[model samples]
Target: MSANCSWRSSCGRAVWRSSRSSSCSSRRPGAARPGRTDLASVPNGQAPVLPRTTRLFQGRVHAASITHIKPPSVRAAVPRRPAPEPEPSGAEPPLVATDRLRKTYRSGDLETEALRGVDLAIRQGERVAIMGPSGCGKTTLLNCLSGLEDPTSGTVRIQGTDLYALGDRERTRFRARMMGFVFQSFNLLPVLTAAENVELPLLVTGVRSRSAREQALEALRLVGLSERAEHTPAELSGGEQQRVAIARSLVHDPPIVWADEPTGNLDSENSQDIMALIERLNAETQKTFVIVTHDPDIAGRCHRTIRMASGQVVPEPVTPRAKGRARAAEAKR
Candidate 1:
């Protein structure tokens, strides 16, 4: 009975040893855990003692990894830019306009009113001839309209902007950009060639030298003087020189061209040539021409004519003599 009892005790000890060995083998490297089948084994002495729940283990892993990961680079937000403004339309309203324009000068005890409430509308693409005898405010009205001199009491608008309110520099810039002038004197620089003389206005308006020369060549060609592009005023004939002056007026492609006595210095043949060139340019380019002249034939050839006498535009009188002359002139033309 004692031998049988000792043998039973030894068998029980062997069973406990086998169960502990099996448990230790299940937790060995690369072996499955008790509740987590997907959990991978770590290196020797580096295995983590994580919580039994999957969520807690994952959360702890994420928290630990965040310390090693760098923060994302931050950048300043940029602002969106606004769109540009639209330009004004519809022919830009004539480039020049006058409303009851008046100009009077007082010298000591003498008083002379050059312009007396002149109401005028000079639109784009229209050729106009202001014809009258001498000393009738043609030059005075031009000066006022060009912003070279302000009216005594009136308003003048250029490119739909008020000119009388502008200061001297602004007025000068406006003139350079929006207007061109020609005169009988052929205001060419004595030292410059024909192309250079034509480019003067572009230089004033800030056109680069290369582009200004190209534009000057084009202006000369438009006036049928491409061959004389290098000639000086002294080298050219009176007609050719006047054409050069006209080209100079057109170099910047100004919207308004005002010519005062453009052909007064030329003979009849030269006058006819200059007038024909002006007419052609007006027809081809649709540029506005406001010519002040004493020549009735030149005025009659224009599309519209305004007769100014004593600072007032005298209406065409409905008389038999005037009617007969008009009919005769029409027949001749």
Candidate 2:
């Protein structure tokens, strides 16, 4: 409490020397205090140093202004958002589309070209049949269009998403969410019952068990196999198994369905029945159907047939009935 108090600073540096008669511990209301010790002041364009026991605050230290003493609160930084997917530039993009689509398989330079620049477009809710002779890239085209196989040198867009551009896991998830596939082999697990087989797709998508079961039962009923829901694949006949597969395909309620010779293993009666069921379902659901088949009878039932040969779409042959029908439609118009 001395009248002449000075800091015993090292290096013989004296920052402040208040020549006041009053002591600092007992100062009046308007008494003079020390100078430039607060962070807001910067005299001589330089920061002043204080006592060793005193706290050093930031003001104009060197060149940059620092506000280190009881600074105002600032909001936490928010992360930047990711860029959105580039939307397809069209009034309505095709449900399934391909441009210059090609697929080739190579086993140590033993190459086999399965698809050659196949340009295809299927609109939403259209039942389109793809018919071709054996080994004519029907299955390969189906696989490419449905995102099951990647084409070597072309693009496949499903619902405006680039199929190959997605990673494997993302593409698989996209397929599980947006597509349904029915194969010729009736690829049902032997241990699972018909209902279990039907619900597998829904279950994979994180649908609740009760909801998945209800949807599976509804899909089975749609395919006319509700009564046989408890039967295993071995217990069901070939036709019934295929119906179960069809039920499984539809269980997820996807917008597009792909069938690769779905009735190839069934008898003629069963094939007819299955095709009839498919036609009815297509009418009811208004879902896009892309069926790969060689049977003329099955191809004849669709809205139009796309014939493939040598990995290319050949022109469809116009039958006389088609000409007559076109003329009749023209007359009606």
Candidate 3:
């Protein structure tokens, strides 16, 4: 064999032949040695025998070519999944909703119906006024809707959660957390100062005294009653007392405020001032308001009015000016 003649083994490792001999030698089997081959070591007309473990080119074997093995293909019988239901479009769930709400008061054989299948929806941030003549169930509706009183039949939902579904204690706790109430009577304690009155809600909810005091002061400041925080309800004027009551209602930052004749006890100027303050609060905080009032002026100032009579909602015609104002408000939003 010529000294330059060489060939690679089937294992891909280089097998070299000595210049003086035809036999091939490798440093180790299966080790690569570039620029070397074992072709020269093969006898004239015969191929060299390689180790049994060696693999040939194209997956072949020296004695006989081995067939390529493949795994059988499988098709799983997977059921097609059903498509998802489409979500509602542009339809916001009501912040407050009542369905066929009814309230009946009974005394011995005498029974008085306060609400009769009143279905209503109040959107978030809406200033809604409920107005009607005396014996119209306005106060009863407010009480039922605020979770303060139980409805005779049907559902009251706040923020999509059914208020009446909760137990009495749970409902009370939920109201403390989710609602604020402003009454015409200005229900502040006689002994507690304005700040203490404002902080009462927080204390009931287990807030620390110092923190509650700070929050109370802040709430008072919001209502421009910071200077009067130290004054008791007795020392405060009627208007100032009402302002204190407003502060107390808002101190906890509830999302919904139920005002039942908030300005009923105030003079005309004071009533205007209170309504202005309420409007400012609604504009600033976006808190939803459900005000029960007989005053058309107050009702007109609200974004919408709901009139009730004989325990049923009476549909009122929308004036062009009111429609224009509503459109303008919606456009601004």
lDDT of 3 at 181: 92
Query: Model 1, 47: alpha-carbon shift in Å?
Result: 99
Which digits, one per residue and each the tens of the lDDT, describe model 1 over residues 198-308?
A: 988888778999999999999999999999988888899989888999998898888889998899999998898888999899879888898988897787667667778
Q: List, residue by residue over 117-153, the lDDT tens digit for candidate 3.
A: 9999998888999999899899999999999889999
TM-score to true structure, per model: 0.67, 0.69, 0.73
The better candidate by TM-score, 2 or 3, is 3
Clashes of 3: 4
| Candidate 1, superposed: residue stretches over 4 Å from native | 1-95, 317-333
The per-model lDDT (C-alpha) reads 0.75, 0.81, 0.83
Error of 3 at 161 (Å): 1.1
Query: lDDT score, residue 110, model 1?
Result: 95
Q: What shift in Å separates residue 326 of candidate 1 from its native position after superposition? A: 14
For model 2, residues 63-137, the per-residue Cα lDDT tens digits are: 223233221223455899999988867646678888999899999969998898999888887788999889999
Q: Listing every candidate in turn, what is its Cα RMSD in Å to the true structure after a full C-alpha superposition? A: 21.0, 15.4, 14.6
